[model samples]
Target: MQTSPQAIFFDVNETLLDLQPVKESVAAALGGSKELVPLWFTTLLQYSLVSTVGGRYADFGSIATAALQMVARQQGMEFSEAAAKAAVKPVRSLPPHPEVPAALERLNAAGFLLYTLTNSAADALEDQMTHSGLKGYFAGRLSVDGVQKFKPHRDVYTWAAEQVGADPKDCLLVAAHGWDVAGAGWAGMQTAFIARPGQVTYPLADAPDHTFPDLDRLADALTMR
Candidate 1:
């Protein structure tokens, strides 16, 4: 098993910030039903991967808007650029999941260097973390924007490790998304899969070094304090 990681890189969005509000906003703007949120989000991820694999670059916010338009048209819903922006604006202001603060505190107290490596742009991630009251617990934050690519792309993980002076094998990625765990595993980083409700690890990927239902349990397992 992979061990002795020198740094921990966290995935933001669903892993930390509660996306329920964003989902509700999406629902209100579209079908007036929250179920559309998952479909829209899945479309967003698909296109993000497409853009990266095709060697095109666009900030995530722009991509989110485009994805919204595509989904709206597919659903025959009215979607203006302004309306799309309004629907997703809540993303910048989401609250951290209930267990996040104390668990991060536990990890920090135990002397692990914690950082966030997100698909968001740097300024956007700053706003989200600051608004969520999670900014101070991390030593730093890295974004795929800096690498001009999205997660599941090997370079993004390698670039994040380089930014912090850690080898891929010496870093651990903690995320709730199966795609993320699979990507990090392929990139040679140890991983902790947070199988939050409705989330599951990728069956085809190598298993995570640790798995937990929530951050609190992960803290209990990893924290020295």
Candidate 2:
């Protein structure tokens, strides 16, 4: 049986916020090669971990721009970092997933303490939550930038838990990315894997405490508890 958690932490990008607009922007910049969007995102995540493990830190926007440039170069296209930044500029104002508002309302009404735990920088997160109209639902907004590490990094997860005054085990991390779920689980947090379209869990990782197709179902489940 699952017990209620002290707080629920959400991953910002692609979990609560939709990424389709950013994907389309990247595709257009890549000469309409929509196929490269996933590659660019994967590269972005890969290098985030690389920087963390390498004991270096760069803001998420800088890493994303660099990843875009790398993907462009692989396709034999010359892209300036400035161009890459422009390509992914839509990230800051991404809209929430369609069901996000109502689901968050339900969760908030149920008295669940909601907070965002994201890899985006503080300013970027503020822009996103405010632009997406999600700012009112959360009690706190946490950024990995504070710890100088990225998601899937144990330190980041633990740091978020500490910020919210919850034990790692008392926090439930909800994320669309497998790496985020795995990292939170390994850090002793309860995990809910939001298997959003095209998202899947890592095969080698421990299974999440809960799996739901979307936030609607997740809200249904959590509220019932």
Candidate 3:
């Protein structure tokens, strides 16, 4: 079995926080078609990478709004920038997954330094943490905006490790996204994949050091470790 990590960095969206509210908002903007919600989110992630690869930086909120507009175009609907922005606004107030608070408490009490590493801007991350009531459990928050690159990027993972003053190998990146886990692994950090519903590891990527159905299970395993 592997030893415990010195610190843990969490991915914010769809990992600690539920994305249902934001997906509902996006669905409303897309004429009540829930199916289009995933398209918008995937488009947002795609364009974020485009921004990074092209050496340009745009805040995630702006990218979300733009991606919503793109989805509207795909469906032959006209979407106003203001309307799209409104749809993406609920992201700032998403609720934490039911098990997140208790799990975080367990991790914190176990003496692991907990921090958030996310693509959201600093202010946005603050709003999310405060709104979700998960703020007090964390010791700090790190945002990719600080380095103008999004997660799954090598620089972003390495940068976050440095921010926590931990060697990459000593840090554990706990994320619901397979891509995030893969990136952290590629960056030389330990990884725990929180297999949130519908999320799976990429077949070609190295397996995560730990895989659990939820954070509660992860906490149980970690404390035992």
lDDT (C-alpha, whole model) for all candidates: 0.90, 0.94, 0.92
Candidate 3 lDDT tens digits, 64-168 = 999999999999999799999999999999999999999999989999899999999889999999999999998988899889999889999889888888889
Query: What TM value does model 3 have?
Result: 0.98
Off by over 4 Å in 1: none
On lDDT, who's better, 2 or 3? 2
Q: How do the candidates rank by lDDT, highest first?
A: 2, 3, 1
TM-score leaderboard ranking: 3, 2, 1
Error of 1 at 12 (Å): 0.6
On the 0 to 100 scale, the lDDT of residue 60 in model 2 is: 92
For residues 1-225, could you state the per-residue lDDT of candidate 2 as single tens digits? 156899999999999999999999999999999999999999999999999999999999999999999999999999788899999999999999999999999999999999999999999999999899999999999999889999999999899999989899999999999999999999999999988888999989999999999899999998887
Candidate 1: give the clashing pairs. Answer: none
How far residue 31's Cα lies from its native spot in candidate 2, in Å, is: 0.8
The RMSD (Cα, Å) of candidate 3 is 0.9
Roughly what TM-score does model 1 have, to 2 decimal places? 0.97
The alpha-carbon lDDT assigned to residue 28 of candidate 1 equals: 87
